[model samples]
Target chain A: MPEAVPDQFQGFAVDKKENWNRPKLTSYDRKPINAHDVVLKNETCGLCYSDIHTVQANWSPIARDNLVVGHEIVGKVIAVGDKVTEFKIGDRVGIGAASSSCRECNRCKSDNEQYCKTQAATYNSKDVRSDGYVTQGGYSSHSIADELFCFKIPDDLPSKYASPLMCAGITVFSPLIRNLGGADAKGKNVGIIGIGGLGHLALQFANAMGANVVAFSRSSSKKQQALELGAHEFIATGEDKDWAEKYDDYFDLILNCASGVDGLNLEEYLSVLKVDKKFVSVGLPPVEEKFEVSPFTFLKQGASFGSSLLGSKAEVQQMLDIAAKHNVKPMIEEIPISEENCAKALDRCEAGDVRYRFVFTDFDKAFTA
Target chain B: MPEAVPDQFQGFAVDKKENWNRPKLTSYDRKPINAHDVVLKNETCGLCYSDIHTVQANWSPIARDNLVVGHEIVGKVIAVGDKVTEFKIGDRVGIGAASSSCRECNRCKSDNEQYCKTQAATYNSKDVRSDGYVTQGGYSSHSIADELFCFKIPDDLPSKYASPLMCAGITVFSPLIRNLGGADAKGKNVGIIGIGGLGHLALQFANAMGANVVAFSRSSSKKQQALELGAHEFIATGEDKDWAEKYDDYFDLILNCASGVDGLNLEEYLSVLKVDKKFVSVGLPPVEEKFEVSPFTFLKQGASFGSSLLGSKAEVQQMLDIAAKHNVKPMIEEIPISEENCAKALDRCEAGDVRYRFVFTDFDKAFTA
Candidate 1:
C-alpha cells in the first residue's frame, strides 16, 4: 500500500450542472480514519439507476450540486478507527446504500438503520457529524463509513458479484427473507415482477432460499435469462392473454421491482396472492401513474402490498452468507475507472447495455499518481 | 320438535315469474339431516349487504332465478347426522357467508375454505352434491348446512351478537387477527374504516383483542356509536381535515370496511400505516374499485395494503372463543320474521338505517301451518 496520498487518487466526481454531463477522475483526499470508521479501497463500486438518476438529475428532489454517485461499495478495509472492534485493516468489507444512522434509535438498535429517523445515504445526504461533511459515495478509489454501517464480505463471495448485491440484492433480499417468515422457511412460491437488477437478484435469492422462483417481465426477451437465473417459471405479462387467471392465487409472496405502477395492475397481482399473501415493492418511481385496486382485493383474499428500502448491514451480511452458500453470482461487467470510460459506462447503463450490473474498478486506474 | 310435516308446508312459495327475485323456500321439507349436515331452526337471521345484492335482479351471468339470500344465520341445531361428532341436537350453531367447500383441496385442507376451488356460499350457491341442490340460506325458516361450516355459538354469547360474527364479524376479524400477529402478541393500533356493520364488529373485535381501536366514518354522527362499540378514537373523514396527515403512520393495521369502489383513496390510508403494517379491506361491493397508491408508500416504509376474506372454521372458533372470553358483543336490532317484513329489512339494510346488524325472529310465523 502507498504510504503517501496519491497526487491524483482515482475518483469519478460529477458536477451537477446541466452543461457538465460527465464524471471525471481526480485527486481525492482521504480523511485520517476516525475512531469509529473504516476506509475502503474500492475494488468495485456497482453502477445503478440511482447513480444515473443522481448524475443526470432525472428524479425529483435530486442533488442540485456536485455529487459522487455510487453506493454499492465493496472492497478491503485499508484502515480502521481505534474504536472499531468488528473490523481491522486489510479485512474485506462492503457498504450498501446507507452510510450512517442514529445508533440510539430503536430501528438502529434492531439493526434496521436504513429506516432510522436520522439516516444518511451514501451520496447526496448531509452527514450527521459535528464537522458536517456531506456524504460522498464509492465512485472513487476509496470511501469511508461508520463500522456499524459496514459489512464484512464473505471470503468466497467475489467482490464483482457482491458489489451489486450490496444495493440491488439487499433491496430485494431483505423483503423476501423478512416477509417469508425469515431466512429459514422454504417451498414458498416467490414471484419476482421484473427481470432487471433487483428482479434478477431477487430471483437468484428466492431460488437459493428453496423457494419456487417465478419471474415476471414485460418483454419475452428476458424469458431465457430469467429461467437461466433459476426462475422456475417466466411470465411475460405483455404476451399473455388473461394471464392473471392462470396465476390467480398462485404466489405466496410477490416482489415487484418495476419502477412504473402501470406495468402491473395491482388488483390482478392481489388476485394472484393467496389468502394472507403479501405483495412487496422496492422500487421508488413517480406517483402520477395511477394504481387502481379495489378494497375487495384486500378484503376477500387477506393479501397485502407494501415496499422495502435497502437492507441494513445485518441483512446485507445475511444476504451475503446466503449468496456464498448458494454460490450465487450476479452477471456483471467491470469497467476501468477514468473520466471518458466512466461516462461511457454510465451511458451504457442508462441505455440498458449491461446484462445485469456495472462495477467501476477505481483501485488500478490512470489517474492514480 | 314437530313429529310430522305441516300440511301448509307448500304455502307462500317463490313466485316462478319473480323467482329470480328470491328462491323457493316453501319446499323446505326439513328433511332428515345428513351425516355432515347440521339442521339449524332459525331464531335470528341478520341481513347482510350481500343478501340484497344477490336478489337485486340486475347483475347475472352466474345468477339463478331460485337464489336464496341470507348468510348471517343464528339458530339451534334441531338434529345431527349419524356421522357427525362436533354437534348434536340442541347445540346452538351459526352459519356465515360460506356453507360448503371441497375439503380435499389445498385451501380447504389448510382451513381456508373461503378460497376453496369448489366452495359454496351460504346463499345463491350451488351445493356440491351429485344432484346439486341450489343452496338456500337463512331467509327461510330452516337452514341446513355442512357441519364444517357450522360454528358453535358460545354459551354466554347472545344469539343476535353471535349471528353477525358468522359473516360481518369474521370478515374484519380475519384481517385484524392475522395482521396483528393474532390476539396473544403485542397489541397494535388498528383502524376500522367505515362504521357500518363490518366496521362496528371490527372495532369490537380489535378492542377485545387488546388493540388500540380507531373508527373511520364518513359522518360525525357515527362518533358516539363507534366509541360505544369499543373504538378508542374516531376519524370522520368528512369532518376531519388532514386527518390522514394528522395520524400518518399511526396505525399498525387499517381494516377498510367500505363496500364501494367510489370515494375511497388508498394512498391517503397507506400514509397512516406504519412500517410492515397492513391496510386490509373485507367489504366486497359488486364493482371493482381502483386504489390510487404510489409504489413508494409500500417500498420505502415496507408497509402493506391488501384484503382478507372470512376466516376458516378454526379461525371462526378462535374468534368466537375470544369473543366469549372478552364478552365482545355487537350492537344489533331485532325484527319479527314474516313475509310482509322481508322487503322492509332489505330496504332498511340498504339505506343503512339499522344500528349495526338486524336479526330476524318469529320463524314460526313464516313457517307455520
Candidate 2:
C-alpha cells in the first residue's frame, strides 16, 4: 500500500540554483513516515558549525539543490510508522547528527553505528533508504527519521535548552566517557580548549562529572563567564606565553574543542597532559594542514589522542538522563524560526557573535497552522 | 666513613675525549657497591637499537663523557649490599632500559616509575644514587645497580633467550597489557607490524594472550616464518596495494612495531582498526618527520593512537611472569662479548641482518678474567 501524503510544511532551505545561492523560506511537500520512521513536529533546532558547513557547501560537495540543514533537533512526535514501537504520538523526541545506518553491519550491531561506512547524517546526506532523494534536516516545521536514530527526550527538559545537547553535548561527552572510563570521573582533572559553544557545554559536563575543569581560550576575556559556566580554572593560551609549559603533566584528560588551524600549538597542550593521560579532539581542522605528532613525545609520556563523532543513540539517552540528574543546563539564546531570522543567525554564527548557541523556535505557524 | 672499594672489573667504554669518538674494548674501573645496591658478574647482555642510538649519538645529546652502552643485562649477583633484600649472592637477575627512579614520587609509587622525569637508564643516564659516576650497563663484567631495578630471572627461562626480554620483551608487552585492557584478551584480533625483534616477541605475547594475530610486513617473504612465530594470518602491504582497504575495521588491537620512517602509510593501517580500537606503537621514528593525523579521520572512526615506554619495574617483573607462564620466548642469536663482535652486531642490527636479537656473552673474560 502507498503511504499517505502529509500536509505541506515550510522550511528554510539553501537554494543552490538561485542567483546568489542563499537560503530562502519556501513551502515543500513532506514525505510520509516509512515503516520504522517517526515524523516529528519540529519545536526547536540548534545551529551548529556543521549547519553553516552544509548551507554554504564548505567541507564537501553538496549534492542537493535545495537542502534544509540542522541536526540538533527537538520536537513532539506527531506520527509513528507501523514498525516503530519505541515512540507514540505526543512523545517528546530528538534526532542528533546521525539519522540512519545499516543496522546489519558489525559496527551497527556492536554499539558503534556512528562509524559504520553506510552511516547517514541528518542533512544533505544520501538517503540510503531507497538510495534516492536526500535526507533533509531539522530546519523545517517537520522532520522524518528512523526510529533507530530518534531519541525520546526527557519530559522535564525544556526543548530550547535540550536542542544543543543533542549535538554539541554528545560530541565531547562521548570521548570523555569512552576514553577516560566514565563521565562520573570523580576527582579527575579535565582540560577543555576553545571556550565557545562546544567548549562551554563540555566544561559544564566535565564539571558535573565531579572533575576539576580547566578552560583554555585565546585570552582571559571569558574568565568570569567560564568560571560561571562551571570551569574551575581558565587559561588564556595567547595571553600567557608559558601557560602550556607551566602546567606540565597537569591534565588527566584534555578535550580539544578547538582546531589547530587557528595557530594553536598542540604540542604545548600535549605537554600539559599527565603520564598515561588522554587527549581527545572533537574539532576538525582544515584539510590542508596536517598536525605533526612526535613519536618521541607521545611514547615517552605514554599519552594518547582520540576523536569522537556525535555519539550513539544509547549515549544520547544517557546524556539526557545525566543532564537531568545532575541539573546540567546548556546555555543558549532562542531565535524565532523565520527565514529572515535564520539568515541573520547564520551570519552571526559565522562571525562568532553569538554568546554560545542559537536555537530556533516558533514552529506552530510553519507547520499545522 | 667512605665505603670500602670492591674488586674492580673491566668493560667496553666510550671515552668522549678520544679523537675518533667510538666505543672500544678498553679497561675501565667499575664503581663500588652501595647500600641497597647489587653487584653482578655479568653473564649475558642483549644488543638493542638503543645501543646504536646511544653509541652513535643519533638521538638526544650525550651528557656522559665515559658512557658504557648496554641495558638488556642478565647476570648472577656476586655481591649484595647490607640492605639488599630481593637478591642474595649467586642470585640471577636482569636489568632493562631503566635503572633507577625517585621511588617516592607519585608516578613511582603508583607503579609508573618508567615515566618519572628523573628516571635513570642503565647506560649514559643520570644515577639517582648518591654515587658520583654515571650508571654503567651490561657490557662490563661487574656492574652496580640499585635493588629496585633488579628483576629476578626465572629458573626455567634460559639466560641467553631471556636477555632480550628484559628490554625488547617488556617494550611491546607493556602496551598490550596496559592499553588493550589486561593481557588476557582472548579471541581478539591483533596486528603486529614489522616481523623482526620487537614484532616477533609481540606476536608471541599476543598469541599467548589468546588473541588472533595478523603479521603485516613489507612483503610475503616472512609468511612462513611469521606463521611459525604465532601469526594466524600474514599481510604483504607492499605487494598488495589494497591490503589496508580489504581489511577495513578488522583488528581490535594493532601494535605498530614498525616505524613511520620506513615509509609505512600509517593512515592506511589505521583503516584496519575497528571503532574504539587502539593502535599503539613502541618504536620511535625519525624526529624530523611528523605523521599527519586528520581530525576528520580520527573523529569519524573513533579510534585512538598511543605510544608506550618500556614497562615499569613491577610491570617488568609481571611481564617475565607472564612470559614464563605462557612459554613466550624471544628469538635471539648469541655473540661473544668482544669489542670486535659487539661492533659488528651493532652494524648488522642496523642492516637488519640478525634473525631477531643479538645477545653478547663471554663477559667473564671481558671483565673479571
Best by TM-score: 2
lDDT of each: 0.75, 0.80
| Model 2 spans > 4 angstroms off | A1-10, A15-21, A26-32, A56-58, A240-249, A259-262, A365-369, B1-9, B14-22, B28-34, B130-133
> What is the CAPRI rating of model 2's predicted complex?
medium
Q: Candidate 2 chain A vs. true chain A: TM-score?
A: 0.93
Worst 10 residues of 1 chain B by lDDT: B4-13
Shift of residue A28 alpha carbon in model 1, Å: 9.4
How does candidate 1 fare on TM-score?
A: 0.86
- Which lDDT tens digits does candidate 2 get at residues A277-367? 7788887665555666767768657887777788888888788888998888878889988777887888888788888999998877655
How well does candidate 2 score on lDDT at residue B314?
80
- List model 2 lDDT by residue over B166-255, tens digit each: 889999998888866787878688999998888999989888888899999998988999999989999998898888778887888889
Angstrom error of the Cα, residue A339, model 1: value is: 3.9
Predicted candidate 1 versus true structure: per-residue lDDT over B335-366, tens digit per residue: 87665566667768878788788887777767
Interface RMSD of 1: 2.2
